[model samples]
Target: MFKQMVIILMTSVLVNNYVLNKFLGICPFLGVSKKLKQAAGMSVAVIFVQVMATAATWPIYTFLLVPNNLKYLETIVFILVIAALVQFVEMALKKFIPSLYKSLGVYLPLITTNCAVLGVCLNNISDGYGFAESLVSALGCGLGFMLAMVLFAGVRGRMESSDVPKAFRGLPITLIAASIVSLSFYGFRGIIDNLFK
Candidate 1:
């Protein structure tokens, strides 16, 4: 049980990273990652929503969806849960953490539809993770998303200060950078296997 928990935690963060490996949440990766501050804000928001969504959805799936054989309804139910969670988090942040809400702004709402968030829940179900394991995996995956976003934002910030050709000025260069980062993450696969062994 402990070993399975560890595996889920490690894999979600490194081996099966949401951004680099699964290619989820690339929209925000390119859209809101221009500045470190914005990247950090989005990361925090994602962490909050992902963790809560996982916690909430796992039970719903286990007790409600699976028992009824309504697995086909997974996408709809998961999405509804994520949307409501994001709204709740946004309101709470605005009330208690005004600065954070300002930092996150429109991006917070955008995250409601983020495929990565939905993808995490679905992945957890597909992997047959129990409640505790799913929660850990979701947390790790959220952190991993934050890590990738911050790293990419830093790289992008540097790119803004550097000289580059006109044609490859924006997304082209960013794609190249992401490709390199993805390749680097591939190295973690072997490390994950070794850790599990």
Candidate 2:
């Protein structure tokens, strides 16, 4: 059990990273990564929604869907849970953390469809992780996403002031940078294997 927990955490945070390994949320990676401030805001929002959605969806899968042999409903249920969770988080942030809401702004809605969130939930289910493990995995995945996005944002900010060829000016350069980061993350595969073993 302890080993499983560690595996979930390590895999989500590094080995199977949503951004670098899974390539789940590249849209936001490229779009909201222009500014470190915005990147931080989006990351926080993702963490909140992802954790909440995982907490909510895990039980629904384990207690409701799995029991009834309705596993086919997993995808739909997960999507609904994530969407509602994102909406609730958005409203709560607007009421209490007005500044955060302002910073997150439109990106809050984007969280609903963010493939990273859905990917985490699906991965958790496929791995046969229990409620607690799933939650931890989701949180780790969210943190990993934030880490990657913030790192990319900082790099891009510097790149904005750097000289580069005209052909590799925008998306091409960004993809190249992402590929480098992805290669770096591959090192974590050893950590994941050791943890699981």
Candidate 3:
């Protein structure tokens, strides 16, 4: 069981990253990643939301939805849970850390619709993970998202200083950088299995 949990955690963090590898949440990946501070703030918010969403959704699926023949409503339930969690985070940030709340701006609310958070909850159910495993998976995916955002922010920072051709100046160069970052995550594909071997 321990080994399985470790494998799940590592696989989600590196091999099956929601952002870079799976392409689940690309909007904030590009929008907030312009500055390191914004990226870090958004990443932390996302991590909090993912873990909290999984915590809320897993038991609801297992105890409520599964037994009541309401399995078809998992998508709706999960979204509501995620949106609520995002709102909670937004309020907390606004009250406690107004600077970060303002820095996040519209992207903070965007977490409500972040497919990465939704995907984690849905994938946890589909993968038949136990409660603990689901939480670990969400945490791993959250860290993976943070990693991608920070790295891309660094890349974008460099791009800001570099001299680029007029053709690939803005969105074009950004997409190219994002693609390269996504490809880099493929390097971890077989690593988890090898580590446990």
Candidate 4:
């Protein structure tokens, strides 16, 4: 069980990363990564949402959708679940962590539409993961997102201090950086297979 859990974690975080490999949550990936503090705050929000969404939506699919043959509504159900979860998080942040909430501002609210949250929930059902496995996958997805965000924050920070052509100074260079990061992650293909071999 422990070994399988490790595999799931590695696969999610490193092998099939939501941001770098799957390209699921590029909005916040690029937006919040401008500063390390902002990136960390956003990552924590996403991780919280990922775990909560997986917990909230999985049993609904298994007990409600699967048994009732309502699988066709899986996407809609997951989206609603995630949106509600984000709203809850938003409210909690506003109440207890107003500083972070204010810092996050519009980007935080935008998490409602972050496909990564819904993607993990949908994948949990589609992959037939049990509750524990779904949680592990969510952890991986969140950590992977955090990893990419923090790493790119460092990259962007360095970029800001360096000299670059005027035309490639902003979003253009950022996109190129993202592409390079994605290409690096791509090289890990079949890594899970080889690890167990």
Cα-lDDT of candidate 1 = 0.88
Cα displacement (Å) at residue 105, model 4:
7.3
Model 4 lDDT-worst window of ten: 100-109
Which window of 10 residues has the lowest lDDT sum in candidate 3? 100-109
| Model 4 Cα lDDT, one tens digit per residue, 103-124 | 6555557788898988898888
lDDT of 1 by residue, 1-197 (tens): 88877877788888888998889999988888898988988888888788899999999999999899998999999999999888888889899989877877667888987888999899989988888988999999999999999998888888888998999888899999899988988888777678678
* Winner by lDDT between candidate 3 and candidate 1: 3
Candidate 2 TM-score to native: 0.91
Q: Model 3, range 74-179, lDDT digits (tens) per residue?
A: 9999998888877887888889988977866556677887899999999999998889999999999999999999999999999999999999999899999999
**Backbone collision count in every prediction?**
0, 0, 0, 0
TM-score of each: 0.92, 0.91, 0.91, 0.90
Give lDDT tens digits, candidate 2, residues 49-80. 88888888888988999889999999888998
- lDDT, residue 30, model 4: 87
Candidate 4 TM-score over all chains jointly? 0.90
Better of 2 and 3 by lDDT: 3
- Model 1 segments more than 4 A misplaced: 96-100
Best model number under TM-score: 1
Error of 3 at 97 (Å): 7.1
